[model samples]
Target: MENKKIILIVLATLIIGAGLGWLIKPTEDKTNEISENHSLESLDHQEIWTCSMHPQIRQSEPGACPICGMELIPLKKEDLGADPDSYQMSENAMKLANITSEIVGMGNASKELRLNGKIQVDERNAYSQSTHIPGRVESLSINFTGEKVSRGQTLAMVYSPELVTAQEELLQAASIKESQPELFEAAKEKLKNWKIGNTQIDRILANGKAIQRFPIGADVNGIVTEKMVELGDYVERGMPIYEISDLSKVWVLFDLYESELAWVKEGSKISYTVNSLPGETFEGTISFIDPIINSQTRVASARVEVNNKDGRLKPEMFVSGIIKNDNTDNDTQELVIPKSAVLWTGKRSVVYIKETVDGRSSFKLREIVLGPGLGDSYVVEEGLNSGEEIVTNGTFTVDAAVQLSGRPSMMSPREKETQKTNKFISVTLSEKEKQQFEPILSDYLEFKDALVADDFSSAKKLVIILDKRVKMLKTSELKEESAKIWGTFQKELIKSTQSMISSNDLQEMRNNFDELSETTIGMVNSFKLTSKELFVLHCPMANSNKGAFWLSESSDVKNPYYGSAMLTCGEVKSTLK
Candidate 1:
């Protein structure tokens, strides 16, 4: 009986062990298979290394960048195949580059006013020194411009015939004062009319002599700004002999731009600096605001009164000034960012926000409501918060990454597509004529590449070349639909290129070029062309040799290859190799 029980226990134990093994065996196999697949994927998508400062420098293995000499950082495996112009930094790379971002917040709304004006003589203190008598200038005491003078100081000697006659009449009247007392009084009054002082007249009367010439004295103390007559020069009646300006008080004129006009008002205090006096600063009070705005610059003039007792400030001196606006009335203080931080897109503005996961850095896009731009910064109207970090420098790179990810950026993808469609509809290109159309498309891509590299000279050259090529293509053979589409595309491309040319913003030119290239490529893909037709009509002058061509028959039309086979001449091929 004991032997039988022991056998049964042993058999049961064996059965239990077998069942456990069956259940656990598949789970281990599945885990191993998943691990193997993950390893294979990682091998295919190996990380690349690059420099932050020199984005163009890329290496398959990790090390320092030769150009920048900064430690190379591993690039995200997923972003390895992104556009060359588009920059994408991995978490480690962002930290190494010291790149950070923050959320945007609303801040107080205040106006920033930029005023421009020149230095001018104070109108109240400016005086024109002139001789009252009709006479000839005998000698000028003040000979040069900017010579200082004092009140009652002699500026010139004038020999006036009328004054000589009046003085002689006074002497004659004095001799016969008892017989013609009224005549003596009239003669004294005539001397006073010629601006002869009472002391000089009394001396002349006491000496019984008639003074032939009188000294022209300065009426107000100032500097000689205009010397009208030289020594021994003939002077006309009531003609100005000299122009004088009192430097004790002066006016500083500022030209305020249209946007800054609202913040600057009469009586605002301003601080200024002159290039001549680098370290010295002066303060003034706003006294006047011009009602008219300049037609060309759209700026209004603002006048400020300055005290220049030291005579350091001179008229026509270039001055740079700042006005501190009182934000007391603006009850709300909102988040503020540097003007350079906001990227404008005609209708909207965008800012890049830095995101952190357990202190690991990443970048994200944020649309912002932008207020008027201050001299160096901007007040955030909305879509931001206080203490949030943002990408102040290298924002263009961040924006490019956002665009590559197919995210809604400052400009929507839908809008871009619509614009491209409209442009394609306006161009005049034949459906079957691939030679002329292929070159235009190829030229656009080259222009885009040049722009991305910030090579303005190359971009301009490409633009000119494209224009010439378009001109050479015969419009007679073009189909109505094709011509209209080509026309629209050309118009838009021309407009964008022209804008870049005018502004001279290399970055904007580059961005526009990218848009144009993408739009052209998309249109080509949508239109469709077969592999055989594409090879026959391919762009011969293409830099990358990746352009497709259309065939004479509609039935042969197919999708152009994109992605891995971007340069392949085929019907949407998955890979080129």
Candidate 2:
């Protein structure tokens, strides 16, 4: 009977325990579920922020940018899936960056070419102060260069053995003048040949001894530019003692570049300002144009004569001149764009065209053909239409956004298929010049293969060889317009290769290789130098996903940018035959 009573007690205890556990389970699980729901909701609501100046920076919360210390802004979803070719900027970001845009229109095309030059001496009025007799310079009346001397002014004193002998002959002839009048006349004629005046000869005859030192006089009133002989320095007869230039008239020689050669004529009117003299404007007509272009400076001179009786304009003084080169072509309307809006390379002008779609402003980089420069503006020859708006101020800011977003920027030479107008270099290559690029093309292909194989050393050597071949390409036979284009392309090509040569790492060289490929593609298209089949391959994942091209002798894909990691990450973009 006691055992049965204990069993009943145990069963009752078990039943009570089970009932208590069931009662607490629902409440506990419900509380935990609520906590998890709250946590997930808070995490989902978090926003992403970035800096306008530094777009690469991304943060989960609002804060200052780590790189540039700029205030972070919320990355708007408005441009999330917008046009790939355009850079969309929020209104708030534009205001914070101090960016401004302007609407452009067609106007009368007038270009004012501004040239930098300096005041120079007129060659016509310049004269050499030369010695009539061989002598050693004893003393100089005009001690230094730029000292003024009047006509017949005693420039220097020279000890001349020839003049002393001539004077001695005069003295000897004067002693026997009564017996030999002809000899006396001949001796006086000899002194006159040495530019000796009658008074000086008479004084010498009065002294009855040869004058050891004779005075050299100036033939023209001018400033001495150069003193060729110093004290005790021997000079030859008819040798220049001083280079003197007349200040009554001067030449304002403006530096004329190869691109500006066509616009400048022999009689173009120019209005200029001297840097030394403020608030004064001078005007003159271009009197002469240099026949030969200077090899080193690659510029010619346009001479403009100016009357300077007041001696205001001095030699070596910097001057800014403007020439109004009116465009006579009435068929093409002039679309003037702000100079600040344009980002220029050697042969290209880039502008950001702004278009507002659905209240979101998008900027697209457009390469334009620049016409004549109008002081602070440029005439748009191509790549733009009237009534278009562009980024006038803070253009670089817009370009930066476009560049980071993987669109065409000033540095990236991206070619868009849908582009309305293409950049026209207006260039051609001769047969000999085309043949000259064979070794260049051969080396370039090897360089591309080296990068594809991830061989940095081989690429360095091949690029160096390619650079030499490019530099040695004969461009002298190119016509004026063609030469200008060739020079621009050549400089950019060399610059790209030189960057690779100086790179410290393989990745850096590959980055420069894209630029090299761009310059090569441009040259090939314009020059049409290919004789055999070649392929232009493009890697969409190259240049930080902005896309890059490389020349290949074969149509097979071999990615130079990604190398062994993504060897075949390219497509045959085009073929050249």
Candidate 3:
């Protein structure tokens, strides 16, 4: 009876344990299944963080950017079904990007060209006060640089022996009127040829004494621009004693840039002001437009005739003026935007357009055809429509983000892919090649670090190491495209090193590092990896020729060969041992 009772207890305990295990197992499985589903949802809605200044910097989690070290912001996905290349910024994003918009329409529009000019003497009325007879300056009446003088006013007294002789001949001719009529006439004409007035000749004859000196008079009623002679100074015949200009009418010379030439013409009205006379507004009519442009400044001169009866306008005084072109009849308007809206890539011009739908925003980069540029703005000839919003202030930051997102951008993504792939191939280098390439990369890193520190000595030492490594590479596994790439890189490195050795300019050295990084990245891109398993060791900072590492999937993106940056940001093919 005791054995049977123990067996019954064991059976009952086993039954209870089995029931408990079955009940808890389903709960555990359901909890695990819920956890897995949550993880999948999180993966689907993962957020990407990017920097405003360095767009190529992307982090799976929110943090600061590695390139510019700026705080990263979330990149929101657009719901507007916009083009994949387009980015729409929310109201907040627009504010952060400093995006602004303006409505463009057809209307009669004219540009006001502000020109810088100076008060100049009317060249047409300028004359030199010169003496006809060779003589010594007995007295100078005009002594200052800007003294006013009148027509026929005595500017200087010149004493000449030639004039005295001519006067004596005239007196002798006057006494012998009938005996030698031709001789008398010839002598009188000779005295007149010496510029002696009739009154002076009559005085000499009446006094019965020859005068050795004559007064040099100004030819025009004007101011003395230059005084060339002083009292007691000897002057040659026909030499100018003073430079006189008629200031009653002066010229305001306006320097017009090449673009302003189309609107400016002869007889166009202009309004001008001088800093010295603030309240007094001066007006003039354009009388002349210079046919030739100044080569150095690419500016053409426009001469405006101004009345200067008061003599307030002086030569060489700086003047500012405006020329208004009338476009009232044309009725055609041009699309214009701020000059800051355009991005110049040396070869191509670009602008970022924001597309908004249902209050959501995205950005799209558009290539623009720009016409004549006005002050602070550019006339849009094509690429943009009547209504488009553009990011004026923070386009560079946006482009940086576009590059880091592994999307097609203004820069070639394929080139970046090629660089990344070639870096992976570089890992399969022969032991000797590795030895040669290792030191080169190490030196490049040192140079980059030194540059960041602004340390010249350490940078120079690293540059020398790179120079030596490149020289060694000239004889090693350098062949085909790799050889060409390394050869070009070596040449640039040598040039940069030479620049550093010759000059102590830190900026120059930094520029050399930029070139070196570019060349090395190109060298890395020239090689292809036959085996996917092999990977190259690369320094993100040292390898970047354009100065930033960019994450991209397209091989066509601009790499070191085409852009300013060398290193590409993307998934690592294999970890560096």
Give lDDT for model 1.
0.66
Clashing pairs in 2: none
Model 2: per-residue Cα lDDT over 34-142, one tens digit each: 9999998776566778766445557888987553345788876665445556788889999998899999998777667889999988888889889987889988888
Best by lDDT: 2
Candidate 3 runs further than 4 Å off: 1-82, 103-109, 326-329, 357-359, 410-577
Can you write out model 1's per-residue Cα lDDT over 292-342, one digit (the tens) per residue? 998997877899888889988899988888887844367766567887678
What is candidate 2's TM-score against the reference? 0.51
Alpha carbon lDDT of each predicted model:
0.66, 0.83, 0.67
Better of 1 and 3 by TM-score: 3
- TM-scores for all predictions: 0.53, 0.51, 0.58
* Candidate 3 residue-wise lDDT, 336-368, digit = tens: 787877888776678877666767766667888
Off by over 4 Å in 1: 1-99, 108-120, 172-177, 203-209, 274-288, 294-304, 314-318, 326-330, 352-368, 382-392, 402-412, 416-577
Q: Once model 3 is optimally superposed onto the true structure by TM-score, how far is the C-alpha of residue 424 displaced, in angstroms?
A: 35
Choose the strongest candidate by TM-score. Answer: 3
